[model samples]
Target: MQQPEPLIPLAVPPDWQDAGSAILGGDGVRRVLVLGAPDAGKSSFCRLVLQQASRRGRPASLLDVDLGQKQLGPPACVTLGLADAAGGVPGLCALSFQGSLEPLAAWPRLIPGTARLAAAAPPGLLLVNTSGLLKGAGRRLKAAKIAALRPDLLVAIGADAALEAVLADHPHIPVRRLARPAQAVRKGGNRRRRLRAEAFAAYFAPAPAWPIDLAGLRMEQAGVTPWPAPRQLVALLDGAGHDLALALVEAPDEPHRLRLRAPRVESPVAGLRWGGLWLDPGWNAHEIPRPPRA
Candidate 1:
């Protein structure tokens, strides 16, 4: 028998034009949900949509829900960015800290946090980019968000059978199925970890240590977890309980005082929320226990 040639992945996704037309077809599209497995070209599709929207002179925003590999902002966060009409560079307007990179472990906060950020986005076409987690609880997490956010359009990349269950639950939402990009290459576990570490390091590259007085500030954990401790990640929240920025807790500089290494936070830090995971000096996240309640 003659041998057939091996298939090679192309550098560009074949369905880009089709996907673009399906997503940006009409002016009625307010919210779009992009779902797919890892390396399925979801982010690339988002960039394409943003560029098209800018060219069309329509205001657009992106709500990124990918905690592990973010397209808009830092890792372990759900961020909202407004597309610059002139420059095409999205600017971070708001963010909510989920703290865990694993979607399965962070779904409890992910669903609600996504909705909150989406709601806070400016009036325009809102494109939501999700993490590449389409199995088991990850699939369920996407379905729950679909129910919660009630997006106007659902963009599903790849032909995973698991997506059927997710799409089946929401028949009213229009779905645009696109083939997985030929150039998509799966990332290994170690590479993912390394990428996360690199993201964290870059986020805190110019961080300066700030000594905060913990006398009257509210400090609490997201769920059942330990109180704010050294080397753990913490969210600096405003009076409205919105995350201003991420900070690393450091050993107390003085009695009843807390120190943090974080970016410059212009907003006044009214509260402190203990993030779900901890990071070492290298910014690699370490999972903590979610102990049973009493």
Candidate 2:
């Protein structure tokens, strides 16, 4: 693959100059994963990289694995897009994982979904935008993800002293630290909820409520046990278990059929799996309330 071209002369800010040159220079960096705390400007930096590529005649795709505060796809899904730097968030291809706000509970699905998205991305500069969960188990998930993707470059957007221990194992990979953009805004709970709601609304629009037979499709990553509860969020998947669409289990109509509200699908669905997400009619995620005693 042709090494991605460097930013057009004087196009990048002084802060990102070295990193940009490093990525576009010597041997050429093909894959990169940008890490940072919440509101640390990871996505902002991603836009810069794509902008440079756009101006220099280089092609690139961005793989966004952040389930919340999503820019490309719905909440709880890992999505990718061939970006237009000037256009901002582009058309998305999604792989639905666990749809909760936090990624910790969905590590099993997140890692594989990330890897699959990375592998499927078109050849060029593949810039990965990660979530802001950067402490404790979140750190471990980051470590595991690095090990799995084996990116060509690791860019940390802020003070990464906490990442030193986990990064110790990968001495061969180079890491670039960039200061968080001063203009980046820190999102509050209400803002986060609003953004997540917008993403979910985009997913549920237009498609009429549809009922599907649970027996016709197979389920994988179906969680620890089968759930028969109402209003639980379930994922419609392909035979290989990629997300085809998301639905609410309105009710169990029979032993093998479910009443649901889901987006229409163009292809046949091969699996029905629930991620324990209890979504209200608006598709906003909520805690699964206790089951009433029989």
Candidate 3:
């Protein structure tokens, strides 16, 4: 009998051990979506998650779908070393945008691409990084389309109002927010920067909630709000150790309503906004009440 060709051994990255360990601890989540606004730290968050997985010895594939920035690949613009390290895994594959919306605008085409890439992924996990589009109706539509793919986890980075809005409509999905790393950079010296980084890291290590006085807020659509001064409310929520998700507002005499899992709370703050409130990651798509049939 002819000798069979030897199977080539793949080179595992140095950090693969750590990455694998983290993957084993999670609930066998195979697919994830990294979402947020531009510069909202989506890319960095992706790196951190993948790096952790790689360090634990878990091999996961990454797909970069941020067509607007094309942040994942080279001509040596963005640092894609994380993707490179991930590629070393035996069954991993990473795909980057060619820097255009035309490719992503066609949803029918993108779905097959995601499926094909996922098929080749290792049994561990697959992470997809999406663009951070905060404004415009088109951007919102695009985000909604992407969310329909139904990844196991959805991570939104930075001030991602749009994703928060979308999540209000699809509440059952699991979504997490990651803070930006650059916020750790110090102006004066390296020592300061390191200190700042450590401080910021500590702040994010344990997720916190911030409380807001939502009195007097108005709802424009079902489960959607248009608070003229949202920053103050956001700060209050942050202060309460809660990460701000989407804000739900209700104007007096407005028939539009929000269907939150919990009952409404009466706020002491005068002009407080909102109808029903739920913490981020607390509610999912299934929790959202369905609209009445005509």
Point out where model 2 deviates above 4 Å: 1-13, 21-26, 85-87, 164-166, 220-230, 249-261, 289-294
Candidate with better TM-score, 1 vs 2: 1
Better of 1 and 2 by lDDT: 1
Candidate 2's residue-wise lDDT over 1-294, tens digit each? 011222133334477756765686647689999888888777777867776677767777888888887767667778788867563554665566675556887788788888888888888888888998777898889888898788998887776666565466577888887876666667899877777776766766655676677776776534433664687767888877777767767787877777877767777888877765666766677755436679
Name the 10 consecutive residues with the lowest summed lDDT in model 3.
1-10
Expressed as tens digits, the lDDT of each residue in 1-294 for candidate 3 is 011112111433323333334444779577777766655555455555666666666666566655333333311011112334543312212331121133334344345545544555556666776655545654555555455556876666555567677566556877655454444221244543333234222222343333433445422221223432221111112232221222322222223222222112333222222211122221111112335779
> TM-score winner among the candidates?
1
Ranking by TM-score: 1, 2, 3
**Could you arrange the candidates by lDDT from highest to lowest?**
1, 2, 3
lDDT digits (tens) for residues 190-285 of candidate 1: 987887777677666668898998888888677456567788888899998888988888777888788898887888889888766778878788
- Which of the two candidates, 2 or 3, achieves a greater lDDT against the reference? 2
**CA shift at 76, candidate 3, in angstroms?**
16
Error of 2 at 179 (Å): 1.1
Better of 1 and 3 by lDDT: 1
The candidate that achieves the highest lDDT relative to the unseen native structure: 1
Q: What do the candidate models score in CA lDDT, each in turn?
A: 0.79, 0.72, 0.41
Assess every candidate by TM-score: 0.88, 0.82, 0.45
